[model samples]
Target: MLKKDSLLKGTIILAAAALVVRFLGLFQRIPLDYMLGSIGQAAFNSANTIYLLLLTIATGGIPLSISKMISTRYALGRPDEAKRIYQAALMFGAVTGLLLATAMFVLAPVYERLSRVPDSAVSLQAIAPALLLFPIIAMMRGYFQGRQIMAAGGISQIMEQILRLIGGIGLAFIVLGLGWGDKYGAAAVAFGSVLGSIGAFSVMMWFARKLKKQDRDEESAIATDKAAKPSSKLPFRTIYREIFRTSIAAVVTAMTVQFVYFFDQSFFMRLTSVFYNHDTAIKVLAEYTNRAMGIAGIPPILAIALGASIIPVISSAYALKNMEEVQRQSSLVMRIVFFTGVPVALLLTVASYSVTGLLFKSPSGYDTVALLTAGAIFQITMMISNSILYGLNKPKQPMYHTFIGLGLKVVCSLALAPFLGVYGLIIGSSICFIVITLLNVRTINKEINLNILGNKWFAYLAAIAVPALAGWGTEYLVLNLTDAWANKVSYFIAAAVTSVIVGGLYLIMLAALRVITPEDVRSFPGPLRKVLTLVLKPFYKRAA
Candidate 1:
């Protein structure tokens, strides 16, 4: 069993590592975006999406299944049975990984033609080999997680991402330098995934060997103990059934956003064709993926990571039919996600163009970027609510809600396209997640009456709005007074100054509005609590 404090600490360690990996990912993405400009980027991203989908299919459910089965066996004091389960899972991973890798390699051209991108075929094939080892690595990571060794999984992830960045960008740059076109360069970058998987596999192997020895030692001591009884054998067939059962449910519940974005990638070019020639359509698609979607994707991922850390408590409470505890956990999670999400969504929406300039070299789809970033709050809500639903054992409900939202999303995009252009797609994205969030919330209320904000919801809205308006006005003045958009350097300056101003004001609002009380601060991790305490002390004293 995990130590009492280990759960929260482990969650924080994993979440922090996940965030760090995401931050490091930006280095690879930014360079790749510049190297493969509008058209090249569109093609590469399409291939990348396919890769992600396949990856989701290959590894998403299996890891959790492994973790669950292993934890159950070990909890029953069955080390030998746990070892058998791990061995069985490893065999499954090996077989599944081989099949998925072959499928990706063989289907590259079919997907390329469907998506209508030339280099996508090559990119798909380039990244196909990554699936071979990744599923196994995922299994190992899950085993360690089940064993309560969170650092192993975290370390492996960081190692994977770092190697991926180095190999992907470095190879792409070298390819471009060798006078290969961007098309092939994109393929080189795609192959970096293979290197990343190898690096992750290496790290996991070391941990697995160490853990295997520990398991053997424990088993030997048990065998020699007079009081110990021999462990009962678990049938591999029964274990496989259990694994598949959990795996299917997990995959179905987890695919909400990935499907939504897949719809975007599928329909984006066709939608843009209503207003642009072929080349321009490709350019707009590039900007939509790399700028709008790219920047907007960060907040929700991080928010979900944070919100999801408390979920085991929800699961535990719900399993015991403790509705009161369930409500408390759900409401607290939603509030924490909401509080953190507001500032990020606000900042990104207010300075979308400046951020585009600062990060992506220039603002291509200014409205689209702003609208999409604003939509991130909805995305964050959707992600957290879906997770909550899962904890409540309503996995199928989120999947059903997701499909309904996606159907409406398609209709919304078609209806709004004439007036909104790419912003229509952005709005459609928001609407998809919004509808899902609302439906999820409704179901959650029916199940547990989740009142996240009580009567203070309005105050929360005000907290978000005041700072956003202030930030907007500040950016407007900066834009008009100085030609920030005319140069990237000036845009960076404007964004930096505006961020500081908005951040300061938002902190003050947090105190004045009593948004971040000492009680709320105390709930956080020790390091974060200390920093937040120091930063908000003067404000608290002023309020007192």
Candidate 2:
């Protein structure tokens, strides 16, 4: 069994790697936006939305389930059985990926028709081939993740993004500069996805081979008694069945959020097209979706990193039937999420226009971006709660909560879209997340018989709200003060400066109020705390 310290260390390393990849993602999107422009970006985003939905279905839940199965097997000291389980999972994932990819690839025309955009047919066709590559990449990802070698997963993700960035931007510029139509430029961008998937798959396979060799060497050194070793030749069919059974719950649970997105996109498209001219409606929807994808997606990337790490640790603890440890870890994860999520969400919301302009040069998406930033509070809360629910072996509860949110989103979006357009989608999503978060919280309270929403809840709000307000005020001041030089770059710089100042001041305020305890501060990963200290030293020194 891995020690707590070892697990914590692993979590920190994985989180760092995830953060790097997310940061790289931000840089990559900038060039992609230039390549695709507004309409093309929209087309690409739509295709990716479909791909993400399938991805969630294909491999989302498998990692969690595989992690649980492998960890449990390891804890029980059956390495060979664990290896068999891993192989079975890989085989199953491969087949699932291929089937899903094929279906989606073939259904591109159907989706184009449903989307109701003039050139969506061509764009969708351009993106259809990517479906063939996505599932294979996802299967490889799930396999390595199950082995708890997240470094491989992290490296593969970075490599994929790098290839996409280089190939997409390069081809996009070439096509556009060569006087090719937008469709061709978009197609070139989409082609990058194929290259990225191949790079990811290659890296993962290499890592898997190395890991397999290492495992073999370790096993050879051990004294093998018949009692100590399980049967090496388990039936592949039995192994496949076991993996499929274990993975189904995870797949459903993982796809919940994506399902929400699918519902939103479908209804949003229908409502907008019905209420307005098709071209105008498509442009509006494209703008909003791009904004959400660009800005709102960032926090989840970060949250997922931390939340993913929590799953295996919490699952193992629960498997040992240690309720105290489960509660402790769950609480820690939620608190850390709040501590980071609150400030980031607030900053994003406050500086939404500045960020949107700086990142994508698309001012039309600012309002939706702001809404999504605010909505992230609920998103992060729901994510942490859902992770805890799953970790505690209560998968159905999360699924139920997610569906409730999904239903609410559909109804709310339809009711509000005519009047509010993209903002309606944002409002609906926020309301859905709030409802789901509350539901999950209530469920946890009932199960554990603990009032989680006591004084600490208020403290979380204070920790987030105070900094957000200060940051907003400071940013507003800076923007007005620098009006003479308020170009995009200047505005972005001012916003960044204000964000840092406000965030620092907010941390100091939290410290003064003791909202975050000394123990809480200490529990942060050492490197992170060091960075935080460096950022806040001036303020703390003043206070001291």
Candidate 3:
């Protein structure tokens, strides 16, 4: 029903690139955390998250909608239509990006007050320029994806993240060396986003040139038929209408992950003000944003990659009305995300103390880190399922579900933050994701009679429970055993050792439980499959 190995290969490429960027972010935080301290890191995160929320709003829906629409057209043998759609998307992206960038720059002070993080307004203003370029880059990436081309996008992502990291680190060092306070240092780091966007734009423009050449070649080949048809006269207004129809729902669905964080960013301080003093509220929100949000955010990168990759594939299938194929891909992706996401989340939660200690000089946010990381499982599932819903052409389901879940999140956080502090916000987020994930899966099942977990729900719970208990035990033992501790080098050894032992044990249990069976392993792309086979050899063998 589907092309050979496209989904596997595309997902693996995107996943690998996303993995590098995500982990690089952790390593990037090390020096930054030292330079900024918790308060400064808070400033960094406050500006970063505010910038990201607007970035999502500007680029999120357009790119995804392009991918979906273009893929649907191509599946119907309308390559000319697909090309026209991309052109329209490009113009739209440029205009939208300029507007959003201007809005961000003009409203930086408003965001600073809302987030209640001191020294954030300058950083927010500094990061706005990045918004001007990235929307175009994102749309181009989506076009490549619509064409089922993955390399250009993946390479450009690496380029963007690498330059961003280098620029941020370099600028922050210069600011701090000049004896500027954290205020300017944070702004300097935030300005690096503009540098990163330029790098990404360069890579994307190069790819765009090649893509245009290919498009011309395609046009010449099809000039006698498709391109000459009356259908090719489709108007610009129709393009805008179609894009907006999908994009409005798409934007809300895309915000599912960040919407909760935006709530915390905007209201956490204001809500908890009566219960805690200004300094105390700021400290708690800082830890919540910097440490908790940082560690918790890692594993979901894979899900996001897989989710995005699924769009074109799912759109093609949905275009054909092949619900069975949609069902197959949906079930496979859900299991893959959960099976992969659970262990990593549990490890981070169990090892949050060591991880935070390694990254931060004075680690005081381990509890928040643990809470957030523990929630990543649900976060990962919710994301993949959201993608699945989008593929089903039920784009509005995730949008509505996100708002409903946010309502609950807002209520739970407000009602409890007074009593429980940061944990209240985190617990509220966890509940939100869990509810949304379940709702999404239920909707998918209703639409396609999807298979979710089947008889393996307990198997999954055991897979989660066993590794968590063991990893927690191992962490406690190591922390208690190591008195020569708290230094970065010492924490590094503890983290490395714990990761190896826990990771090995977790894989063994997964194999023994048959969480990933031989049939499932075969669906993986060749390189990943080979590596996984070798890793799982002692516990489970692969078919030759």
Candidate 4:
């Protein structure tokens, strides 16, 4: 059995690995935007949206349940049974993945027709082969995660992304430079997913070998204990039933948010195409959507990493009947997410043009991208809270919240798109997020028996908002003083520096007002505090 401390250490390592992967995503998008341009990006993003939806159906909730079941079984000293369960899951995943892939591949033309995207059929065709490969990859990822060897899974993610980053951009540029149309460029990018999946699978295979050796050693120990009692086998039927029972709920809960997004995209595509010419509107909407989504994508990656780590820790706390720890950690996670997200939303709102120019050099997407970036703050808050609810084993609550939000999004998209276009769609989505987040917060408080909306919540809101306004103000002053910087890199640097300065001022003011306790600061990991102290040392000394 793994000690609590050991599990915590593993979680930290996994979080670090996730952070690296997130950073890679940020950098990868830079090159992708450059190579794909706005139109190419639209095709790639559309393909990805479809791919993720399929992936959710293929492996989504099953992996989480697999991990939980395997970990619990292993903790109870049932290693052989756990291994058998892993093998069964692998087989199930393979069959499901292939069937889904085949169906999607065959229906690619149908989707293209429905989306009314003339050249996107080719891109969909190119992405078809990956469906066959990704299931096997996802199964291996789940197997490792079940064994609590999260590092291996994390490494596989990094390897997959690295390959995608290099292969997607490199191939797209080469194809486009060689006179290929945007369809070919999009196809080239789709092909990269296949290579990346293969690379990830290869790395996972090596990790599996190491696991095999460990299992061998474990088997020997089990043999020695066999004489003391007759070993019981969990029948394959029972195992399969158990796996499905646990996995389905997880899958639905995990995929709820993605499913909502997919539905929104499908609606957006159809609505926009209907209101405008097929080619002209699709092209414009695609660019607008990608730019908005690209800016919004950054913060979620971080939230996912943090939230994934938080889940198991929160789960273990619940398992151990440690309600205090559960409440503390949940609140802390919310506060941290709020602190990070609010300032980012404000910065993006204030400097949307600067950010868009710096990141993608596409001035056309500024308005919608700004709206989307602001929406991201609420989106991430909802995500974090929902994950916490999942960790608490109230998966259905999240589903309810998501359904409500999705309804709002669909209604707003349909009602607003005819007149408001992308901006209206964005506003509708943001409003939905805000509503969902508030509802989830209320549900979580009731479930956990904690007051989540008291002084702490109010203080964190003030802390974030005050600093965000200061940052916005500083940005305005700097831009006016320096003639808007003009250069992308220079503007990015100035905006980033200004945000930091303003955030610092906010933190100091909060500290002085005793909004956050010193113990709260002390609760952070030593290294994190050390870095914070280093950043704030000069100011502290001057105050002294």
| Cα lDDT of model 1 by residue, 275-358, tens digit | 767777777777777677778777876665765575688889999999998988788778777766767878888888788877
> Where does the lowest 10-residue lDDT sum fall in candidate 4?
1-10
The digit string of per-residue lDDT tens for model 3 on 1-544 reads: 1122376788788888889888776666667767885557777777788777877887778776687788889899787788788888888779988998898888888877776778778888888899898888889988887877877788888888898889998999999999998888888888888998999899888877877787677667864754346456567799889888878887877776687887887787777887889888877777787667778878888787788688768878989988888888887777677667777888888888888888776568888898889888888988888888877878888989988988999999999887887788888999999999989988887878766567777776777677777777777777777757646766676677778777887777778877777777787657667877788876764432
Per-candidate clashes come to 0, 1, 0, 1
- How do the candidates rank by TM-score, highest first? 1, 4, 3, 2
lDDT agreement with native, every candidate = 0.79, 0.71, 0.80, 0.71
Model 3 stretches with alpha carbons more than 4 Å out: 1-9, 68-84, 213-233, 311-328, 448-453, 508-544
lDDT of 4: 0.71
Candidate 3 lDDT: 0.80
Each candidate structure's TM-score, on Cα atoms with residue i matched to residue i, is: 0.92, 0.87, 0.88, 0.88
Residue-level lDDT tens digits of model 4 in 1-544: 3212256666776677776776666565666666665466666666777887888877877776677778778889777778777787777767876787778778878887776555666667677677776777777766677676777777787888889878877888899999987878987887777778888888988888877877777677765756664554667688778867776656665665566557656666677655666566665666565666767776676677667778877888988989999998888787666545566676676667667767775556677777788888888888788788878987777777777887898888788887776766777788778887888889888857543335666666676667667776776666666665557656676567676766676667555555545455565557656665665555455555
